[model samples]
Target: MKYVQLFFIFLVTAITLRAQTIPYLQRQGTATQLIVEGKPFLMRGGELGNSSASSLAYMEPIWPKLEAMHLNTVLAPVYWDLIEPEEGKFDFSLVDGLLKDARAHDMKLVLLWFGTWKNSMSCYAPLWVKRDLKRFPRAKSAEGVSQEILTPFDDRNRDADVRAFQQLMRHLKEQDGQDHTVVMVQVENEIGMLPSARDHCAAATKAYRQPVPAELMRYLTQHKKELIPELQQHWQANGGKTSGTWEEVFGKSLATDELFMAWHYARYVEAVTAAGKAEYPLPMYLNAALPREGKQPGEYPSAGPLPHLLDVWRAGTPSIDFLSPDFYNPRFQYWNDLYTRSGNPLFIPEIRFETGDEAKAFYAVGHYDALGFSPFSIESTDHPAEEPLGKSYDVLDQLAPQILAKQGSDQLDGVLLDKDALEQQITMGGYVFTVKHDFTLGWSPGAQEEQWPLAGGLILQTGPDDFIVAGTGLVVTFAPVKGNDLIGIGRIDEGEYIDGKWTPGRNLNGDQSHQGRHLRIPVGDFGIQHLTLYRYR
Candidate 1:
């Protein structure tokens, strides 16, 4: 009996170790794929509160909520001030608590290092560092007035950040390293200097006067056609020089100055990340504060990893994996389109948790091929089941396995319908569809013209002749793609979500089923349906 128990213990230990290990991040086509526990893992994560872990008393109540939301990973901020109140002394109780609780809940974590910047401010720096301006100076505006941003030129700031980050990494390696609770680390939380396009400090001035780095210039020249649209347009309209100083090459404008600041800031954070990765090399990424097109530098958050500064950031920082976007705007597709250029993976770390916009989540996961999407303040909702956002997440959780399998393949498509936009069309697996608003052909004519009903749709092709269409507020009609003829084989109604298992629902084979190519749910509500078809002459 003792020998048998010992053998079982050894088997369990080996399996645990194998489940915790992960490899460095690499690019798979246009997407950044992470190898976790010997499998290709896509991050489906949410950003927790910045100070949520400081006291488990606060975080304990929210554990059950997160787990129920079907979140695989959580993005939590680790403040430098709280972790290292003094210069060299480091405290990691908060980080330890986060790791232990995350593991207990069977969730992975992405630690956001709130070091040099947090939302374009140095508010997260240690009190001692923030108090002593001489040791760790702040950036100044063009008028020589100090701003809340930490100067990238300050060696003391960089050293303190590196030391704190290294200690955090070492602790993670020792404690959760074997279990791999933490999969990735974000170097800094939106590092940027705002309220001014360029710093007027002496050190900043000196650096700005220097010529543009040869590597960055080469990248710009080589990839000019693929540059950020606004930047490329500016350069092309201004002679498009391949070699010169920053002003001479990119043109002397507020946009150019902001790009210059981004280069310096990215370089500084890269150094900090490199120091930490030396101890335990894991995948690391950076987050950016996006800006509007016609907005000025100060009008919007500036000096971050916006697309126009992609060249500077790519050339300045190679240690980071990819730059992610935090969404607070309505133009989800447009912003993601800009960020995904040059083969960058799309990862939305934050978005508004509005009940009406639930369908956007589906579009992000299915249509856009985003690695992950998290709606901010996820725990704040009092009744998740009743909320549209929560219900959408529930459906997504049900379909996660299918979605994961078809992530890189062309087997899925999603749509987000607005009140003004009443129709959407998509093609998958040799079938073309024209899906309209549920009220398009039925109900009162005024209903279709009234406020748009918020709805989402997802189509998955199981086989060449089989498909499943699921969601709300949709009227689907299918036709063959080009030369092939499609005939309806049968319809599966009374969809069964069997014990969290998706099997074929009961067949609705009668007059209820149309001639196979056309089916309509006149008054469509929240539901899932499977339509099986056959190819014939």
Candidate 2:
């Protein structure tokens, strides 16, 4: 009788705890937040390289390094082969270990489901699944040559992938559901077709000749105003027809084939996402392998969640929260702007782990009011503390509290610069600021160098005349926004945020401010400066 009562009590406690919270995405005005444990969280996050999360022993040495790097969330892969190596049986040693280690480090996890497809190839699928090609057919090129990529047209392929995924989600619910440690799950990695815009498999080929789905046509018609321009132009040029084959509905082009592929890929992912959500109901998303410049559909990955295919994705996957970008492109602002259109919240899951990644982090969050920012291959660095990314993350940690508060509000903006573009302008608090790269000063050795490093900052309007300016290598000269009036920096206090409050260290007026000409924080110096502006006619 005593044992029965104790078991019942524990079970009820677990049920109640699970009911209290689940990881979700919440929109506060224009900003979106990853709500973990019923609280809004900014993911100061990083993703381990493709193979980093496979071993507990391998990850042990890097925990302290991540702690020093200031990452609060980790995006790691959950291998289909490792978790469910056999047919019906399962093993969760790796999953449980990842959860345990993340909790130990006081970090959150976003599990990437490498099921059936990873980077458009079935490379991550279990050996049993891979070996049985007839059971799970692969996608084919235009000449009927099969590629490693899986075709979405096969229901059998979908069923097997769905089962493995369902099992994974079910296991996650049992293990970490109460803890809310794993916040989000990416359905697959860079899913798309290669060397073919649309799969040449028999089912896919037949479907391509068939009329475009009525649902997709309806979406294009309804969301015409909001649809991306490239897609819209093709639809309009086709006389905005509602009924026709794939090429007839859109146009006869590589993009048309891509449209066909995007729809099928989205539908396939949607089924997986919807089924997984049924078990646990966590927020899910898909990441796009960006299309390179001048590359047609087959030249790139072709279909995976690119901007033009957004409507297709939206039409296909209501279960998906939003589409995310894996940016390796240099035109950071352009790509970010493309992803954030039509109320899609910006989150960069993976980016090139380069020198400018740190600056890009500041520009991304500060300028875009982004949900989160993370650079790829997080464990590859030799000395974590010595890295520029660590310094950038340090500054971001201090400003995070304020950044979250003002994210959806219009009081925040950021700037970015390179050798080609040395300066930019920002308007806030009724004043226009000439924000420029610190290399313009010509005082530092970098000023003499041909290349200008990425310099950027966040301008937060704390009051009508007062503001907080934080970032490296930037100078701001202010003037009245609506009239001809000279605006002078009344006071510029260099400081750091301690315990959510500003502590001033030095006052800049003479050379630091160009003798009251412009307020500046020089190159290679990352700090916060509080400034008060006064305007005179």
Candidate 3:
């Protein structure tokens, strides 16, 4: 009997250890949370510049800067050309060095695989692959001129990428599997076709004339009601044929050309992703370079994972966890709303890395229940500690516990304020909150400026009468949702969370709360305030 008990205990211990080593995504309430080491982790992350992670000695000073900035995760690339220099030879010294440094600094990493494609060019491919044109053909333009991108129609190109990626994953599992310093991986960097919507290479041209795959047609028909408006409208406009060639089914326009290319690109990426996941399953995603407004297909890198091609990518790449946008264009909110369709979790892997990102971070986590957020070229700042983003990150680190708990719940809300869009109304805990940009107040220093700097913050209801508001540049007033009763401020305490505990510093009233008219965190300041409210007739 004692021997039986010991055997059971050993079995349970081994199972738990295996579960704790792999990081994965899980659904929490209405949001999808990345579970690491058996707990939910919010990534306050930044992506290093393209060439930053190529050398360990060059990255020594950069680590301290990242630590000072309060970043918990670093998004660095693992270049294919460097990792696999020769046909079948592999080198993992760069990857190993990155893992060791990140672990030493107590930071997590999201590895970006700069594999077959980077920004629609095959510049990252190994020399052998690039030089052997006969063995591995390049995609051609409409005029039959060869371009730099490898044709996805070739089996050799896809197999080569799969072998390299599988090796990388296998190495990570054998080397750092227990520590799990790496949380997630991006499959490629901004994959898309350049200067043309569809490849005009001989293989591509021949494939384009073949009948559309039955699998994709089935997906569209099965998900007809749920397809994005653009894709659905295009299909319906062209008669929604069940059996026909790419041009015959989707019409002979540039839109159809883009659709054809999108399907092939997704399939190629899926092959690589699936192979890596088989070696070591981690949450994997793809990022898209958003197209500029009014640009037709072929004008920009076409048929990459943009919003319109999401359906095609989804149908092709079941191994890809989700699709994300790399922000270099305008319309932040517009793009975010589109990306979060059909319960897809939001994780911004790359943004412009500017002044207003602090606010967007708050709004993204609070408003959309985003899994994580990151900025591009994160090591460019001169003063890492004094940066506005650093200050914002410090507060976020303190509030991460509460933020993670309240995500996907009505108790949390965030607001982004700018000159044109000054005010937003939020209803929580039976009270209506009127949140506005700090510049809306005439007495503020930058109120009269021609362009107002962006201001934003978040509010979390802790109790029926208690709430916490944290952010920069904002004034808030509250009113009851039901009755026509006046809401009075019982007390407002300016405070900070130390060790996940609220430490109040000042009882803000009179002048601090604008003589009880409103609660304000000035434009230049980043802080947290705990407030208690009461109702009066």
Q: Which candidate achieves the best TM-score against the true structure? A: 3
Q: Pairs clashing in candidate 1?
A: 419-452
Candidate 3 or 2, higher lDDT: 3
What TM-score would candidate 3 get against the native? 0.97
Candidate 3 overall Cα lDDT vs. reference? 0.91
Cα lDDT for residue 387, candidate 1: 59
Cα lDDT of all candidates, in order? 0.75, 0.87, 0.91
Instruction: List TM-scores for all candidates, in order.
Output: 0.90, 0.95, 0.97
How do the residues 292-340 of candidate 2 rate in per-residue lDDT, one tens digit apiece? Answer: 8888888889899988788889999989999999988767888889888
- Provide the global lDDT of candidate 2 against the true structure: 0.87
In model 3, which runs have C-alpha deviations exceeding 4 angstroms?
Answer: 1-21
Model 3 residue 127 lDDT score: 95
Clashes of 3: 0
Looking at model 3, report the run of 10 residues with the lowest lDDT sum. Answer: 12-21
- Displacement of the residue 98 alpha carbon in candidate 2, Å: 1.1
Off-target runs (Cα >4 Å) in candidate 1 are 1-20, 23-30, 42-44, 441-450, 484-489, 494-501, 506-527, 535-537
